[model samples]
Target: MSDNLAINGGPKAITLKQEEALRWPILTEEDEQAVLSVMRRNETSLSEEPMKLEKEFAEYLGADYALAEINGTAALYAALFVLGIGPGDEVISPSYTYWASAMPAATLGAKVIFCEVYPDSLDLDVEDFKKKITPKTKAVIPVHLWGVPCEMDEIINIARNNNIAVIEDACHAHGAEYKGRKTGTLGDFGIFSFQASKNLPGGEGGMLITNNRDHLYKATTLGHYRRAAGLPEEYSKYQHTCLGFKHRMSPLHAAITRVQLKTLDEKNSIRKNNIEKLLKAIEELPGFHIYWPPPHINRVYYENDVVYRGEETGIPIERLIETLKAEGAIVRRDRYPLLHQQPYFIERGSNPEDLPVTREINEHVMALPTFPGDDGRLVEQYIGAFIKAARTF
Candidate 1:
């Protein structure tokens, strides 16, 4: 058979250039022009470009107000501050997410309680989240991990019952929807990062969107002090020394993000189609569980990943990865380090064993190239590599 296993010194399964296939934030001359326009205006530091981005972003998401920030971390911090999450407050977040989702709470002197995620969706487990709430619990952050929207309705109901704020860490989910509503707009406060690697690449920027007027004003005062003069009388006095941090988004970043936003849905559709095509090809293989969002959810792909059930295949996950790599497949273990097990949180009394489901899910997860560019050839090669690797074992 021509399909000899590559691990046995046979010709590799993947022969095409994988770099071009996986290149992200597909830049163009238009992006350059937008940045150049900002530079020509000499408005890089503080300009109307950021405010323009805020309006356009809010409109795109149907949010009542939006505030631009330096980055996703700063936006999260402002969200925590405006929600009154302070010393002694408890914030619940899933352990299977980026650090920015939960670390901001610790900075606000709040106790960051890590929760478990569902093995199937890799999203926040509502049951575990419910169990973690207490009198000190003041907020809950449900991250849309890998562009998969969390169970927002359930989380919102629980938050309402508990009288806690809901902040959606939508950094990974740009243009994703749950039950016909956008991911970021589903929570009390939603934040999106426009970093170079994000779905909407803007070099570096973030946006906080909300329907709450007070929350919007407070977030602005927390980071965008320059806008304080236009705020209500009570907040106008703090124009010169607004809060303690300057989290303003650079005009250049904002300009680039605006251009990216224009084509976000179009680009997201391409990513979704490519991922679906790849998933459909390999989903039938045993021991490999491909993740698909629920019928009501429209997910975008920031990074493609799959769960490997070693027990079903009678092969170790590490060995499987090694075999796939030998076939020229770009595969690796999931990169997110469990936040609960990190040193800073461990010192705060977070036990690694507390979230058994999250740990188990992380152990079996494998990251794959997102294949942002349309490359059916590479996709087919990857599919063949997976089949060849499985048969080899």
Candidate 2:
């Protein structure tokens, strides 16, 4: 079992990540004890554990409030809904993000305004982001893409100047920091995912953090009824007020998250060390460029795609993907395309022109892997495989 390739061929484990997931199955005695603590106490539905988690999270994040939710996507959706983003509103987001980022805006009947990212860092283009802002643009979501920090100070300053709210997609960033502030605390509202492979792996759970009372008040209204424990009594009498949602976290997930949160910094440090090892080894190879690495700003390892700069550059992405997969490294191209380009959105009839940078990056980029069960070895194999794969084209 240990010698097995780190990725699974299972239908559900679409990426090599699944095989990797299997290798590091969560059977930690401490984690099991946490779950047993929940079960032995026989209350598995957001008890004091969740409150403890939230309070600890707030402390960890340096935020005034931390609200646990069902999952990351719901956390984003709830944040937008609570903040009152609705039809005809527009949210500015970098094109290079998970579909979850843009989909929330569109699902709320809001228009998704896409902006380009800096080519070198693959971060949002601050000037381009400001230019794309308009009266209709109600929010700016700077996705700390692949756990790399976007210039959030610049982003926060820009959003404040525009009076627009910022919601950080901190799903890939657990212990990450920028200028002494943690990722979730830097934005108006920060959403984190506890999907299984994350540094804070809870299988499937999410959290939202904020300093604003209004947003927290509204979020609680929509995220749960006050009876859901940990809430002040004043909020208790008001049940189902103003169209609330049933998006509270499960006790099972929360229990696991509580255990994981204790180890977040440790897990993150390991990923960081492995990434440094991978980058140092690969940078010396011809046609390789490492992503962000700097002091204080750290990344939780995630997907990355090798960009080959050479003759026959015009080759379409499908052909490129085929060759790489044949060589046995699971690779996915730039995670998200523009929402306007999505068929459902296009058919529903709203495609704004002039997303040239979004269009370009979506087509050309591919994400590489850097997850647990990982040392730099897979990445090393990938470098050789990528070079060989490119020659085939």
Which ranges in model 1 have alpha carbons more than 4 Å from their true place?
none
What's the TM for model 2? Answer: 0.82
CA deviation > 4 Å runs, candidate 2: 1-27, 228-237, 240-242, 293-296, 310-335, 348-353, 375-393
Q: Candidate 1: lDDT over CA atoms? A: 0.89
| Worst 10 contiguous positions by lDDT, candidate 2 | 4-13
Candidate closest to the true structure, highest TM-score: 1
Report the Cα lDDT for residue 359, model 1. Answer: 88
lDDT of 1 by residue, 71-106 (tens): 999999999999888999999998889888998999
**Cα lDDT tens digits for candidate 2, 299-344:** 5655444443333355456666666575576666754656666776
Clashing pairs in 2: 6-20, 7-19, 8-19, 304-367, 304-368, 305-366, 305-367, 305-368
